[model samples]
Target: MDAFSEFIRGITRDNPILGLVLGLCPALAVTTSVENAIGMSVATAFVLVCSNVFISTLRKQIPSAVRLPIFIIIIATFVSIIRMVMEAYVPSMHAALGIFIPLIVVNCIIIGRAEAYASKNNVFFSFVDALGIAAGFLLVLVLIGGIREILGTGQIVAFGYTLLSLPINPAVTTMIMPPGAFLTIGIIMAVVNYQRAKKRAKGG
Candidate 1:
Protein backbone atom coordinates (compact mmCIF):
# COMPACT_ATOMS: atom_id res chain seq x y z
CA MET A 1 0.00 0.00 0.00
CA ASP A 2 1.05 3.59 -0.59
CA ALA A 3 1.47 4.61 3.03
CA PHE A 4 1.21 8.34 2.42
CA SER A 5 -1.92 7.89 0.33
CA GLU A 6 -3.48 5.80 3.04
CA PHE A 7 -2.66 8.54 5.53
CA ILE A 8 -3.91 11.40 3.40
CA ARG A 9 -7.11 9.60 2.48
CA GLY A 10 -8.28 9.88 6.07
CA ILE A 11 -7.68 13.63 6.01
CA THR A 12 -9.85 14.14 2.94
CA ARG A 13 -11.55 11.36 0.96
CA ASP A 14 -12.65 9.39 4.02
CA ASN A 15 -12.75 11.94 6.83
CA PRO A 16 -14.52 10.28 9.73
CA ILE A 17 -16.64 13.30 10.47
CA LEU A 18 -17.11 15.14 7.17
CA GLY A 19 -17.19 12.10 4.89
CA LEU A 20 -18.30 9.23 7.12
CA VAL A 21 -20.26 11.31 9.65
CA LEU A 22 -19.09 9.24 12.60
CA GLY A 23 -18.40 10.34 16.20
CA LEU A 24 -20.53 13.39 16.38
CA CYS A 25 -21.13 13.38 20.12
CA PRO A 26 -17.69 14.47 21.30
CA ALA A 27 -17.12 16.43 18.14
CA LEU A 28 -19.96 18.74 19.10
CA ALA A 29 -19.84 18.49 22.84
CA VAL A 30 -16.29 19.74 23.43
CA THR A 31 -15.65 21.81 20.31
CA THR A 32 -16.60 25.10 21.86
CA SER A 33 -13.12 26.44 21.16
CA VAL A 34 -9.97 25.54 19.28
CA GLU A 35 -8.22 24.59 22.52
CA ASN A 36 -10.91 22.09 23.49
CA ALA A 37 -10.87 20.65 20.01
CA ILE A 38 -7.11 20.18 20.09
CA GLY A 39 -7.28 18.64 23.55
CA MET A 40 -9.81 16.08 22.41
CA SER A 41 -7.87 15.50 19.21
CA VAL A 42 -4.63 14.71 21.04
CA ALA A 43 -6.34 12.35 23.46
CA THR A 44 -8.08 10.52 20.65
CA ALA A 45 -4.92 10.41 18.55
CA PHE A 46 -2.88 8.91 21.36
CA VAL A 47 -5.48 6.23 21.92
CA LEU A 48 -5.84 5.50 18.22
CA VAL A 49 -2.13 5.16 17.46
CA CYS A 50 -1.41 3.13 20.59
CA SER A 51 -4.42 0.89 20.12
CA ASN A 52 -3.64 0.38 16.46
CA VAL A 53 -0.16 -0.76 17.31
CA PHE A 54 -1.33 -2.92 20.18
CA ILE A 55 -4.03 -4.61 18.13
CA SER A 56 -2.06 -5.00 14.92
CA THR A 57 0.82 -6.54 16.82
CA LEU A 58 -1.52 -9.24 18.10
CA ARG A 59 -3.76 -9.65 15.09
CA LYS A 60 -2.52 -13.14 14.45
CA GLN A 61 -2.96 -14.36 18.01
CA ILE A 62 -6.39 -12.95 18.71
CA PRO A 63 -9.10 -15.46 17.98
CA SER A 64 -11.66 -14.25 15.51
CA ALA A 65 -14.66 -15.12 17.67
CA VAL A 66 -13.37 -13.08 20.59
CA ARG A 67 -11.36 -10.41 18.80
CA LEU A 68 -13.85 -7.66 19.46
CA PRO A 69 -13.59 -8.04 23.22
CA ILE A 70 -9.82 -8.04 23.08
CA PHE A 71 -9.83 -4.91 21.01
CA ILE A 72 -12.06 -3.18 23.58
CA ILE A 73 -9.75 -4.19 26.39
CA ILE A 74 -6.68 -2.87 24.64
CA ILE A 75 -8.42 0.36 23.72
CA ALA A 76 -9.74 0.88 27.22
CA THR A 77 -6.32 0.31 28.67
CA PHE A 78 -4.89 3.08 26.56
CA VAL A 79 -7.82 5.35 27.33
CA SER A 80 -7.18 4.94 31.03
CA ILE A 81 -3.56 5.88 30.52
CA ILE A 82 -4.61 8.99 28.67
CA ARG A 83 -7.00 9.98 31.44
CA MET A 84 -4.32 9.68 34.06
CA VAL A 85 -1.75 11.66 32.11
CA MET A 86 -4.24 14.37 31.37
CA GLU A 87 -5.44 14.53 34.96
CA ALA A 88 -1.89 14.74 36.19
CA TYR A 89 -0.44 17.29 33.80
CA VAL A 90 -3.11 19.10 31.85
CA PRO A 91 -5.79 18.99 34.49
CA SER A 92 -7.52 22.00 32.98
CA MET A 93 -7.98 20.26 29.68
CA HIS A 94 -8.88 17.06 31.49
CA ALA A 95 -11.46 18.89 33.50
CA ALA A 96 -12.76 20.65 30.43
CA LEU A 97 -13.14 17.42 28.50
CA GLY A 98 -14.51 15.52 31.54
CA ILE A 99 -16.30 12.25 30.72
CA PHE A 100 -15.59 12.65 27.05
CA ILE A 101 -12.09 11.42 27.76
CA PRO A 102 -13.51 8.14 29.01
CA LEU A 103 -15.99 8.27 26.19
CA ILE A 104 -13.02 7.82 23.85
CA VAL A 105 -12.89 4.21 24.97
CA VAL A 106 -16.10 3.53 23.08
CA ASN A 107 -15.76 6.11 20.33
CA CYS A 108 -17.04 4.55 17.13
CA ILE A 109 -14.10 6.02 15.25
CA ILE A 110 -11.59 4.14 17.38
CA ILE A 111 -13.44 0.82 17.46
CA GLY A 112 -14.55 0.97 13.86
CA ARG A 113 -11.03 1.55 12.60
CA ALA A 114 -9.65 -1.09 14.96
CA GLU A 115 -12.10 -3.62 13.56
CA ALA A 116 -12.15 -2.72 9.87
CA TYR A 117 -8.52 -1.82 9.15
CA ALA A 118 -6.15 -2.41 12.05
CA SER A 119 -7.26 -5.98 12.63
CA LYS A 120 -6.65 -7.04 9.06
CA ASN A 121 -3.71 -4.84 8.21
CA ASN A 122 -0.02 -4.87 9.01
CA VAL A 123 1.29 -2.81 11.91
CA PHE A 124 2.71 -0.01 9.72
CA PHE A 125 -0.43 0.41 7.66
CA SER A 126 -2.63 0.28 10.73
CA PHE A 127 -0.54 2.99 12.36
CA VAL A 128 -0.80 5.16 9.28
CA ASP A 129 -4.54 4.59 9.03
CA ALA A 130 -5.11 5.49 12.64
CA LEU A 131 -3.02 8.62 12.39
CA GLY A 132 -4.79 9.65 9.20
CA ILE A 133 -8.22 9.33 10.73
CA ALA A 134 -7.06 11.20 13.81
CA ALA A 135 -5.74 13.99 11.63
CA GLY A 136 -9.05 14.21 9.83
CA PHE A 137 -10.86 14.47 13.13
CA LEU A 138 -8.49 17.19 14.30
CA LEU A 139 -8.97 19.16 11.14
CA VAL A 140 -12.75 19.19 11.34
CA LEU A 141 -12.82 19.82 15.07
CA VAL A 142 -10.54 22.84 14.74
CA LEU A 143 -12.51 24.24 11.83
CA ILE A 144 -15.86 23.96 13.56
CA GLY A 145 -14.38 25.17 16.82
CA GLY A 146 -12.75 28.18 15.23
CA ILE A 147 -16.08 29.15 13.75
CA ARG A 148 -18.00 28.73 16.99
CA GLU A 149 -15.47 30.44 19.19
CA ILE A 150 -15.10 33.42 16.92
CA LEU A 151 -18.79 33.88 16.30
CA GLY A 152 -20.08 32.98 19.71
CA THR A 153 -17.63 34.94 21.79
CA GLY A 154 -16.60 37.58 19.28
CA GLN A 155 -13.10 36.20 19.57
CA ILE A 156 -11.03 33.07 19.27
CA VAL A 157 -8.41 31.88 21.72
CA ALA A 158 -6.41 28.71 21.44
CA PHE A 159 -4.04 27.43 24.10
CA GLY A 160 -4.00 30.83 25.79
CA TYR A 161 -3.09 32.53 22.54
CA THR A 162 -5.55 34.90 21.02
CA LEU A 163 -5.97 34.19 17.33
CA LEU A 164 -8.69 36.67 16.56
CA SER A 165 -11.00 39.12 18.23
CA LEU A 166 -13.79 41.46 17.32
CA PRO A 167 -14.56 44.74 19.00
CA ILE A 168 -18.27 44.24 18.56
CA ASN A 169 -20.95 41.98 19.98
CA PRO A 170 -20.81 38.30 19.20
CA ALA A 171 -22.67 37.13 16.16
CA VAL A 172 -24.73 34.52 18.00
CA THR A 173 -23.79 32.86 21.27
CA THR A 174 -25.91 29.89 20.18
CA MET A 175 -23.18 29.00 17.71
CA ILE A 176 -21.13 27.79 20.66
CA MET A 177 -24.14 26.13 22.20
CA PRO A 178 -25.53 22.64 21.42
CA PRO A 179 -28.00 23.73 18.77
CA GLY A 180 -25.29 25.67 16.96
CA ALA A 181 -23.18 22.55 16.62
CA PHE A 182 -25.85 20.91 14.50
CA LEU A 183 -26.27 24.09 12.51
CA THR A 184 -22.53 24.46 11.91
CA ILE A 185 -22.10 20.84 10.92
CA GLY A 186 -25.10 21.04 8.69
CA ILE A 187 -23.76 24.07 6.89
CA ILE A 188 -20.32 22.53 6.54
CA MET A 189 -21.81 19.32 5.17
CA ALA A 190 -23.87 21.30 2.72
CA VAL A 191 -20.80 23.13 1.48
CA VAL A 192 -18.82 19.94 1.18
CA ASN A 193 -21.61 18.27 -0.77
CA TYR A 194 -21.88 21.23 -3.06
CA GLN A 195 -18.19 21.12 -3.81
CA ARG A 196 -18.42 17.42 -4.51
CA ALA A 197 -21.30 17.94 -6.89
CA LYS A 198 -19.39 20.63 -8.70
CA LYS A 199 -16.38 18.39 -9.05
CA ARG A 200 -18.55 15.62 -10.47
CA ALA A 201 -20.19 17.96 -12.95
CA LYS A 202 -16.78 19.12 -14.19
CA GLY A 203 -15.91 15.47 -14.71
CA GLY A 204 -12.99 15.71 -12.33
Candidate 2:
Protein backbone atom coordinates (compact mmCIF):
# COMPACT_ATOMS: atom_id res chain seq x y z
CA MET A 1 0.00 0.00 0.00
CA ASP A 2 2.81 2.37 0.76
CA ALA A 3 4.36 1.68 -2.62
CA PHE A 4 1.04 2.17 -4.34
CA SER A 5 0.61 5.47 -2.58
CA GLU A 6 4.08 6.49 -3.66
CA PHE A 7 3.21 5.59 -7.23
CA ILE A 8 0.10 7.74 -7.21
CA ARG A 9 1.94 10.55 -5.48
CA GLY A 10 4.56 10.68 -8.22
CA ILE A 11 1.92 10.90 -10.96
CA THR A 12 -0.45 13.54 -9.62
CA ARG A 13 0.57 14.87 -6.23
CA ASP A 14 4.16 15.33 -7.30
CA ASN A 15 4.10 15.13 -11.09
CA PRO A 16 7.49 15.94 -12.59
CA ILE A 17 5.96 18.15 -15.24
CA LEU A 18 2.98 19.91 -13.71
CA GLY A 19 3.58 19.74 -9.98
CA LEU A 20 7.35 19.98 -9.83
CA VAL A 21 7.68 21.70 -13.21
CA LEU A 22 10.86 19.87 -14.15
CA GLY A 23 11.97 18.92 -17.67
CA LEU A 24 10.17 21.75 -19.42
CA CYS A 25 12.80 22.16 -22.13
CA PRO A 26 12.14 18.79 -23.72
CA ALA A 27 8.51 18.93 -22.71
CA LEU A 28 8.08 22.02 -24.85
CA ALA A 29 10.67 21.23 -27.51
CA VAL A 30 9.69 17.72 -28.58
CA THR A 31 5.95 17.92 -28.04
CA THR A 32 5.09 19.20 -31.52
CA SER A 33 3.37 15.92 -32.39
CA VAL A 34 2.00 12.87 -30.64
CA GLU A 35 4.63 10.56 -32.08
CA ASN A 36 7.51 12.73 -30.98
CA ALA A 37 5.97 13.19 -27.58
CA ILE A 38 5.58 9.43 -27.09
CA GLY A 39 9.11 8.82 -28.28
CA MET A 40 10.56 11.37 -25.90
CA SER A 41 8.45 10.05 -23.05
CA VAL A 42 9.55 6.47 -23.65
CA ALA A 43 13.17 7.49 -23.92
CA THR A 44 13.07 9.50 -20.72
CA ALA A 45 11.19 6.73 -18.93
CA PHE A 46 13.85 4.22 -19.84
CA VAL A 47 16.61 6.44 -18.52
CA LEU A 48 14.71 7.36 -15.37
CA VAL A 49 13.65 3.86 -14.37
CA CYS A 50 16.99 2.23 -15.08
CA SER A 51 18.97 4.99 -13.38
CA ASN A 52 16.73 4.87 -10.34
CA VAL A 53 17.08 1.14 -9.94
CA PHE A 54 20.86 1.27 -10.22
CA ILE A 55 21.12 4.23 -7.87
CA SER A 56 18.91 2.63 -5.30
CA THR A 57 20.89 -0.59 -5.48
CA LEU A 58 24.15 1.27 -4.88
CA ARG A 59 22.89 3.92 -2.48
CA LYS A 60 24.97 2.81 0.44
CA GLN A 61 28.14 2.30 -1.55
CA ILE A 62 28.03 5.74 -3.21
CA PRO A 63 29.90 8.29 -1.18
CA SER A 64 27.85 11.41 -0.39
CA ALA A 65 30.45 13.84 -1.73
CA VAL A 66 30.62 12.23 -5.13
CA ARG A 67 26.96 11.21 -5.43
CA LEU A 68 26.13 13.95 -7.97
CA PRO A 69 28.94 12.92 -10.33
CA ILE A 70 28.02 9.26 -9.91
CA PHE A 71 24.40 10.02 -10.73
CA ILE A 72 25.35 12.00 -13.86
CA ILE A 73 27.55 9.13 -15.11
CA ILE A 74 24.81 6.60 -14.54
CA ILE A 75 22.27 8.86 -16.25
CA ALA A 76 24.60 9.51 -19.18
CA THR A 77 25.12 5.79 -19.67
CA PHE A 78 21.38 5.18 -19.93
CA VAL A 79 20.88 8.22 -22.17
CA SER A 80 23.54 6.87 -24.51
CA ILE A 81 21.76 3.54 -24.63
CA ILE A 82 18.52 5.27 -25.50
CA ARG A 83 20.21 7.33 -28.20
CA MET A 84 21.79 4.27 -29.76
CA VAL A 85 18.57 2.26 -29.74
CA MET A 86 16.55 5.10 -31.21
CA GLU A 87 19.14 5.88 -33.87
CA ALA A 88 19.35 2.26 -34.96
CA TYR A 89 15.59 1.67 -35.02
CA VAL A 90 13.34 4.72 -34.88
CA PRO A 91 15.51 6.99 -36.94
CA SER A 92 12.64 9.33 -37.78
CA MET A 93 11.79 9.92 -34.16
CA HIS A 94 15.47 10.13 -33.38
CA ALA A 95 15.87 12.92 -35.90
CA ALA A 96 12.73 14.75 -34.88
CA LEU A 97 13.73 14.72 -31.24
CA GLY A 98 17.30 15.64 -32.26
CA ILE A 99 19.48 17.28 -29.63
CA PHE A 100 16.71 16.96 -27.06
CA ILE A 101 17.38 13.22 -26.92
CA PRO A 102 20.93 13.76 -25.76
CA LEU A 103 19.81 16.56 -23.47
CA ILE A 104 17.77 14.13 -21.38
CA VAL A 105 21.01 13.40 -19.56
CA VAL A 106 20.65 16.80 -17.90
CA ASN A 107 16.86 16.84 -17.51
CA CYS A 108 16.10 17.93 -13.99
CA ILE A 109 13.27 15.45 -13.50
CA ILE A 110 15.63 12.50 -13.84
CA ILE A 111 18.29 14.02 -11.63
CA GLY A 112 15.76 15.29 -9.10
CA ARG A 113 14.11 11.90 -8.74
CA ALA A 114 17.48 10.26 -8.33
CA GLU A 115 18.49 12.65 -5.59
CA ALA A 116 15.16 12.85 -3.80
CA TYR A 117 13.55 9.41 -4.10
CA ALA A 118 15.98 6.83 -5.50
CA SER A 119 18.82 7.88 -3.23
CA LYS A 120 16.68 7.28 -0.17
CA ASN A 121 14.41 4.40 -1.17
CA ASN A 122 14.64 0.70 -1.94
CA VAL A 123 15.03 -0.47 -5.52
CA PHE A 124 11.43 -1.65 -5.83
CA PHE A 125 10.00 1.58 -4.52
CA SER A 126 12.26 3.66 -6.74
CA PHE A 127 11.15 1.68 -9.78
CA VAL A 128 7.51 2.28 -8.94
CA ASP A 129 8.12 5.96 -8.42
CA ALA A 130 9.99 6.26 -11.70
CA LEU A 131 7.18 4.50 -13.57
CA GLY A 132 4.55 6.75 -12.06
CA ILE A 133 6.47 9.93 -12.79
CA ALA A 134 7.18 8.82 -16.32
CA ALA A 135 3.53 8.05 -16.92
CA GLY A 136 2.52 11.42 -15.59
CA PHE A 137 5.04 13.18 -17.81
CA LEU A 138 3.89 11.11 -20.81
CA LEU A 139 0.29 12.00 -20.13
CA VAL A 140 1.01 15.72 -20.22
CA LEU A 141 3.19 15.39 -23.29
CA VAL A 142 0.46 13.55 -25.22
CA LEU A 143 -2.20 16.02 -24.19
CA ILE A 144 -0.09 18.97 -25.26
CA GLY A 145 1.02 17.27 -28.44
CA GLY A 146 -2.47 16.13 -29.33
CA ILE A 147 -3.90 19.59 -28.92
CA ARG A 148 -1.15 21.18 -30.94
CA GLU A 149 -1.37 18.62 -33.73
CA ILE A 150 -5.12 18.64 -33.98
CA LEU A 151 -5.38 22.41 -34.01
CA GLY A 152 -2.27 23.19 -35.98
CA THR A 153 -2.30 20.46 -38.59
CA GLY A 154 -5.95 19.39 -38.46
CA GLN A 155 -5.09 15.74 -37.77
CA ILE A 156 -3.91 13.40 -35.06
CA VAL A 157 -2.10 10.18 -35.88
CA ALA A 158 -0.73 7.46 -33.63
CA PHE A 159 1.94 5.59 -35.53
CA GLY A 160 0.32 5.62 -39.00
CA TYR A 161 -3.33 5.59 -37.97
CA THR A 162 -5.42 8.72 -37.92
CA LEU A 163 -7.16 9.35 -34.62
CA LEU A 164 -9.04 12.55 -35.40
CA SER A 165 -9.20 15.20 -38.07
CA LEU A 166 -10.10 18.75 -37.11
CA PRO A 167 -12.08 21.14 -39.20
CA ILE A 168 -9.52 23.32 -40.91
CA ASN A 169 -9.08 26.87 -39.81
CA PRO A 170 -6.56 29.30 -41.30
CA ALA A 171 -6.24 31.01 -37.94
CA VAL A 172 -5.26 27.79 -36.16
CA THR A 173 -1.76 27.80 -37.60
CA THR A 174 -0.48 29.38 -34.41
CA MET A 175 -0.73 26.04 -32.66
CA ILE A 176 2.14 24.63 -34.67
CA MET A 177 4.51 27.32 -33.46
CA PRO A 178 6.39 28.04 -30.25
CA PRO A 179 3.93 30.57 -28.87
CA GLY A 180 1.15 28.05 -29.07
CA ALA A 181 3.11 25.49 -27.12
CA PHE A 182 3.65 28.00 -24.34
CA LEU A 183 -0.01 29.02 -24.33
CA THR A 184 -1.30 25.46 -24.34
CA ILE A 185 0.95 24.40 -21.47
CA GLY A 186 0.22 27.53 -19.51
CA ILE A 187 -3.53 26.99 -19.72
CA ILE A 188 -3.14 23.37 -18.70
CA MET A 189 -0.97 24.29 -15.76
CA ALA A 190 -3.50 26.89 -14.71
CA VAL A 191 -6.35 24.41 -14.86
CA VAL A 192 -4.45 21.81 -12.90
CA ASN A 193 -3.50 24.36 -10.31
CA TYR A 194 -7.08 25.51 -9.93
CA GLN A 195 -8.35 22.00 -9.43
CA ARG A 196 -5.72 21.34 -6.82
CA ALA A 197 -6.65 24.52 -5.01
CA LYS A 198 -10.30 23.53 -5.09
CA LYS A 199 -9.50 20.10 -3.73
CA ARG A 200 -7.42 21.61 -0.96
CA ALA A 201 -10.21 24.01 -0.05
CA LYS A 202 -12.64 21.12 0.16
CA GLY A 203 -10.12 19.22 2.29
CA GLY A 204 -9.40 16.57 -0.29
**Model 2 weakest lDDT span, ten residues long:** 167-176
Residue 194 in model 2: shift from native, Å? 1.4
Backbone clash pairs in model 2 (N, Cα, C under 3 Å; residues 3+ apart or in different chains), count = 0
Q: lDDT tens digits, residues 31-87, model 1?
A: 999999999999999999999988999999999999999999999999999999999
* Per-prediction TM-score: 0.97, 0.97
TM-score of 2: 0.97
Cα lDDT over the full model 2: 0.93
Error of 1 at 196 (Å): 0.9
Clashing pairs in 2: none
